[model samples]
Target chain A: MSASHPSDQDRNESLPGEAAARRVVLSVDAMGGDRGPATVVAGISRSARKNPDIDFILHGPKDELDRLIARKRGLAGRVTVRDASDVVTMHDKPSQVVRHGKSTSMWSALDAVRDGEAEVCVSCGNTGALMALSMMRLRKLPGVNRPAIAVLWPSRNPQGFNVMLDVGADIRADEKDLLQYALMGASYARNGMNLARPRIGLLNVGTEEHKGRPELKVAHELISEAAEQANFEYVGFVEGGDIPGDRCDVIVTDGFTGNVALKTGEGTASLIGDLLKEAFKYSPLSRFAAVLALTSLRRLQKRIDPRRVNGGVFLGLNGPVVKSHGSADAMGVSAAVKLAYQLAASGFQEKIAARVASAVSLAQDAAERGTETE
Target chain B: MSASHPSDQDRNESLPGEAAARRVVLSVDAMGGDRGPATVVAGISRSARKNPDIDFILHGPKDELDRLIARKRGLAGRVTVRDASDVVTMHDKPSQVVRHGKSTSMWSALDAVRDGEAEVCVSCGNTGALMALSMMRLRKLPGVNRPAIAVLWPSRNPQGFNVMLDVGADIRADEKDLLQYALMGASYARNGMNLARPRIGLLNVGTEEHKGRPELKVAHELISEAAEQANFEYVGFVEGGDIPGDRCDVIVTDGFTGNVALKTGEGTASLIGDLLKEAFKYSPLSRFAAVLALTSLRRLQKRIDPRRVNGGVFLGLNGPVVKSHGSADAMGVSAAVKLAYQLAASGFQEKIAARVASAVSLAQDAAERGTETE
Candidate 1:
């Protein structure tokens, strides 16, 4: 909250709002998720009714969204549809959508955020496309090398879960990019987790020097040196298990590995659930046991619902962008809509951008000075 | 069973009664698991009693094993320990331990298997050290270029789980290693799952050839070519989610990525379990509901237990080498021991080695011949 605002903050303030109490959070690319706009409409409609303080504008195919809205008249209360023909499907290549399919829902949604029509833009389109679009349209914060997607995985430890960045954004990375990811992740944890100055960990196989591939080893050095100069806590190294445990709070990894771990976590959770059900089917007696355990199972299901954590915040962009989960249903979409509004009103984007820019500049200056000494 | 054996098998089998059904499966570092040798003892004792067809030589600290076994009279039966003070803890650097600690339980264990005192060797110690010892003592299969670890992950399809290979063995992998992993994984599924010529899928980010990193693209080409000349079916590329949902019977990946995925899966499952308990704790009514649902919950827990899965079999070695889960308890260690025995009795080592040798030779010859055309 003490951080200085960007140049555009003044512009945004006059055009729309600041960290205000209540406002509308417009959503773009409503038809971007697994179930398309219907689910998006359902989520936002529900969210709108639940949060009377907020309003909604769904951007997508007018006809499809309208017909879907007609089916749920009660949900149409605080929601309105802004028709855009483009709908990004799961099968569409990310580049194709970004470079060529600009007319799609994602772009329209991003435009809403850009023009101040929407306080926040949210979509579950291709992660790469979303990153590219948000960065290209909204622009990157000063001193940031690139934007990143941050996901909070459920931790097994008593301490809360850690935030992992660049899940599927930068495939080819360097030590510099990794440093930025750490700073961005830390800034996110600070705002998202409400930490004063969060701890950041570089995800690695081992803690020793030269432990990972040449690039990662160097990245570790850079992050450690940068963290020393920055205001946040820098934990030396974290293993795979540490991300989901109390071992660390902010995990930094390349997009390639991060994406693999994130998706692997998702798939594994699903497998465990399915496998547990099958185990109960081993015999009639076990089946009866499964019935008895239904209440615990339901609670567990809610705790790790794929839908609950559907939105991934695209950090380091100029404005707020919430990337919806790939398989988000109505509830997931609705929650994401509320999440975007909260993020916008919470001043998350401005706060993170200010902190990251300041920290990164300091790191760069320190690195330059170190080189000069050498 | 029909294939030719690798060089290690040939060297080991030269000893007296080495090929006999009652051969001993020597575990060098049996005391390394979290639960110590109790699990190993149970596994070895259980197999000896059930089959009346095998013996187990525990090449570890005899006094320590005795001290523990003294507390459990019934399980101490059918297992023998060779008093060896040397140990290789999980944290020991692999090369350092192998070079300086050759007399360690790990090395001694592998030595037993190598010198023909045991038919196979299983260890729960430092995995890297075990791999080094296996390779150093037994040597790589004549034509086999690399060794890999294969474990079956529970999938969603009614058909059950799928086998994924090379989960953290080699670091910088080439296409040939992936192809070999695929072949080895298929063999395991055929024997372990009783599936005839199971389907094989490359654990890739996408179905397209250019989807993954440079290495994967090259690996995909080689795998497709290898599949054409192999005995099993090659299904094609698969994403992460495919592993849990049984998209294919065999999934292949380089060890680095595989290891992260496996651990993430394990963490996710545990995280869900914790979250469920937390959710239930939210209310007194929910607590009662959790109790009522305990039956189904237990079934789920039983289905996804890492202990049930036990260990990952290190393929491409001269003999059957099972690496128990790093965090294995007494029960899991015991299970891995039984698996090692089963691998020996089923002649899995001989078959794998032979197949690997022939396949490697064939692949090499083809490469040499094919390069002429290119």
Candidate 2:
């Protein structure tokens, strides 16, 4: 299956050749996560200072947001504040936010992007809420039936990153959704990583044709067909263990299973590292040995930390809604902001739309051709 | 819910006393894997030699099995090869063998324990065939509705092992099956590990009460009720990350998801470790540092290797059907033999049957008593 898009050959000129291509896009949800505006403001402030070429829009209670950014003088000029009275609580019901919190910090942030005031939306809060809000407000890209939440994971290799999608967007997805996810993932790789054909894997129980539940079986068939039409490369089924390996560039699965698997991997990595640390501290000799190997251990720790790739982009939506980790700190939030800026800068939306449209078109063409032959 | 049967006061037999109360008994399936009967025979010969008290009844094609052991004349007399003309072929369908090949090597192995020819049945052949044959031959322990495959995972923690059941028994299971899994897992902990009150957890997406699919919701209610009855200590729901951390002694889940999660964790661990090893070989300096940490790395590898704990006993069956790994070698087959012997020694069959019967009886009793009280 093809992972690269032939259509992409003509589209990359927008980056350097076009003078206005670097225009800063995307609105940041200030009142999100444990610390809310304080951390969000700091993260955006850091990104803005690092890269003066980007613009930002912070959405939250005007007075509260302004108060948090009061000390950071120039951030207000670089990024505008959109007045929003309400903040969606961390534990707020996903459906409740979509139905009742239209004027909420999260909704307002996404709305700005939907209205073309910004190109992407960043939030460290409810992922389900962002998914619902984005699809409802901005609408799904043409020909894309379902949206997905894609996150960049720190790969086992030092120089690489693994993109895993449908993190928690849809619980029970059809084959069409899986195909859409692959297209979006491949688009991200080509546009962001410049890979000609990104290796894409279906996150499954095993590599066999009949390994997983029925959804995977159907997804495999559709993905293979989609790849045959040159939408994006479709690699075979990949085990959950292969996520951090160099085996696949993009891995896709239904949200529920993906969420559990991702979290488990995170938890296990941290738990093991911590256990080893404690074990090394048990005796003076081991402690001395740990000190000697501290540099190597730190490098290993840096390779697996979740904080390295903090944002999970809600792909296939009309606009980007990068969901920052719930327990994200200042550095994690900053990393997320930078990722949001890249998603906006990389022309991810346009690339995804083109490839997804082609995939859908191919499906329709197959059906039309079948009828004609009949 | 209660994970084990009979209260702590009733089953507090000391380790020494319990050790004296048991005798190692194993039934060997003399064929399977790449090496077939040769590996099985070698493993049996090695284990019996290592543990003089361990006894074995080798059930298979007697003439061929005898030739495999013909070179080891000293140990040949210690092993008794029972002739079974019909042998379960790896290529044969699992259901077909159980339905027609009742005199096959696998069936005869399970039959040895089922009809009291031996205490435990060990098979390196097809698991489905053994599971099916064991059911038809050994009567189900009363009140035990469905059998589950249980494996003890040695975690990074030195405290104790974690018992995970239903790796691939029932594809989809309801609350009662989960409840039975909890009971069976708890029995292993209390009896095997000598834990006074082993902690029990349901494998889930999250810790929230309302979290999880429909099956988990119902199972949660039943598990809580059983826990309140003091059957086995229920430690509440735990996530996938908790497996390697030893957060709970027993974890219960549906077979399909459980199997995926188990393999995923194992794969990820190996993948990460291998990546680290390769990275360490990048430079001469890094390789030197790795040499210094070789002991620690080897210790970690030994702790996480899947092959080290390859055998999983089919719990809730009337008799034993120990399923060795499909990739089993001589060492793995030897491990399976040891596990089968231990299961018989622990009297798991009778213990689990009584536990299942009592729970059903109590539930029915409460239902009838409520009618009178109301």
Candidate 3:
């Protein structure tokens, strides 16, 4: 799809200089979500209304998107549609997509970010495919052996969230890759959480120095040495239970372990939540108690609501990209959009690139120094 | 520690024939816990009162344990003290313990099970030290590469808990090791949950067959082929979210992932619970609502209490040895003791040994068959 439309140029020319200067354009894939294009359009409309400075390059079939966008009063002015005839289904393999997914909306959305037309891209498509496409289009940052997906987990910190990395970018990470994750995650925390220096912890089975695999021990040493250079405090090794605690702001782990921990945490919270509702509805007495406790329960629910933190940012990429949950509704999608907007506005991608470069050099220097000492 | 006490012989001789036949002696390590010998003694007393047929060989300094046991009304009759002066501090490394922990109560406790004086062993010591002692004393069952620590996680299953293996055993598991874990976990489920045939799932980041590391793919094939011979249904691959769901009765994963997920699940639950309490105590209205919801809240609290399920059973060893939390109180210790008693009474150790032996043979057969086909 071409971007040099006469109407688009006219609309941009009509905008006041200050308003146009402040605009942050986000590329959004309107296809591939389980809820379909209508939800995506509505989610974008919700974000556009809330944040006047945000603009969207909506990628999907033009006819359908135009009809959907017309239903929302103020969304038409902020949204620009790019027609992509094909959709990436959840069943499509990442490898297959890379080989032949040119016409898909997911690819087009990522292409917008790659072409510098959008500051960030957001998609509720298949995570594997999205990661694959993003990596192929945006490419990994220099010295980034393995790009990571950093997620915001509900935590006891004053910020109410903690950044966890390598959520599912790749299944394997060597000691050095873990070190990179620590650095990238810390940068994300610093930029996203507005922390001067975030506390980073390496996720292990135990906090003891000698406890866990040999690689973890090596990673511990590497991360410890790199902490000063990376500008984040290393909290040593932390247990999985520390993920949601105030012990660390950035929790780094291999994607395999981090992904499992992430899903396990979500599953557990959901299980307890469902059980609590069941308890409240058990009998007439509990039903009355539930009514009395409704406000407190609502407050608690708002505190732990998964939708409030719905995005998993693809770190170590050339441009910022967010993978919203496949089943995310309008609010969840809006949350992801907001996170993307925040990252794009703050130029987080550039910050992460600089941080990774320095961290890698420091780690190499430390390794060489160790060899010489030995 | 001598087992040939005149009073023990006298008690055995004095018991009625049926009562003596039904008795199951549990070897107890009465040291290394955060609460010390008093809590262990109280825990043993609690278990002894609840089960008339249960007996204990308590290991600790005789002078200290004897006085502690004397204070309990009915404990002296059921508990026989085996003096072990040395204690394995939590700070002690596993390798050091294996080399020089012979004089520790943790070693003596496992030795009791090794000598057939007790059907099972229960200890609230450093997990690494306890596992080391158990492995060194009891030894691994035939054809077992790595021993796994199987834990009971709260689940939505009919049993209210699911068995997850390698919770904090070794941090690594290959395809063969995973197959062994599957068999051992299934056997534990059969005995612990009393299921005729349990559904076993290989834990992964995703349920897709083509996803995850290479070893997991191999494990999926191996476990699938060995399921019928191993007397359990292989439910293919499962994700972290499945740990607390009804999709599987046993979740098998490498210790690194399992331990992290376990701790993360606990941490997330705790974070949410704490937040709920804070929400309830925010104002007078919430405080009044909390009072009204006290019974329901207590029910929920009791439902998820870690103390109720307080044992991590060491599997793939010659006999069952339970590792209770080091910081356990009387209630937690009693819960571990109860699990030990149940497993010992049901001959769980022998059952697991036989199951592992057969499962190992079946796996070997499957591998050979595949080689012949190739």
Count of backbone clashes, every candidate in sequence: 19, 9, 0
Could you give the interface RMSD of each candidate, to one decimal? 3.1, 2.6, 0.8
Residue-wise C-alpha lDDT for candidate 1, range A220-294, written one tens digit per residue: 667777765556788787767776777677888877778878877878877776666666677776666556556
**Top-scoring candidate (lDDT):** 3
| DockQ per candidate | 0.40, 0.36, 0.77
Clashes of 3: 0
| Model 2: per-residue Cα lDDT over B1-374, one tens digit each | 11221222232222211223344456788875557788788888777666555566787888888888886645555666788888776666667986798678887777777767577778877666777777778867777778888877655445435778887776667777788788878876665555667789998867777677766776776676676554677777788777766678877987776666666666566656765776567667667767766666665655555566768878887766778876687788877766665566567767767777778765445434433443
In candidate 3, what are the lDDT values of residues B33-67, reduced to their tens digit? Answer: 99999999989888878777778899999999999
Q: What TM-score do all the candidates reach, one by one?
A: 0.86, 0.84, 0.94
Better of 2 and 3 by lDDT: 3
Model 3: residue B256 alpha-carbon error in angstroms = 0.9
- Best candidate, DockQ: 3
Task: Output the TM-score of candidate 3.
Answer: 0.94
TM-score of chain B of 3: 0.93
User: Under CAPRI classification, how is model 1 graded?
Assistant: acceptable
* Alpha-carbon runs more than 4 Å astray in model 1: A1-25, A52-57, A63-82, A156-161, A206-210, A277-295, A360-374, B1-17, B21-28, B62-81, B157-161, B277-295, B361-374
Q: Which segments of candidate 3 are over 4 A away from where they belong? A: A1-21, A369-374, B1-21, B368-374
Please, what are the lDDT tens digits per residue for candidate 1 over residues B1-374? 11221213212223223555444445546766666676666656555455444556677778878776566545454456777778788777878876897667787787777777787788887778788778888888777788888886767644456778888777556777787887788777766555667889887666766677766766666666777556678878887777776668888888867777777776677677777677767676667656655675676766666776777888887776888876776667666766665666566677777777668876676555544443
Per-candidate Cα lDDT values, in order, are 0.70, 0.71, 0.86
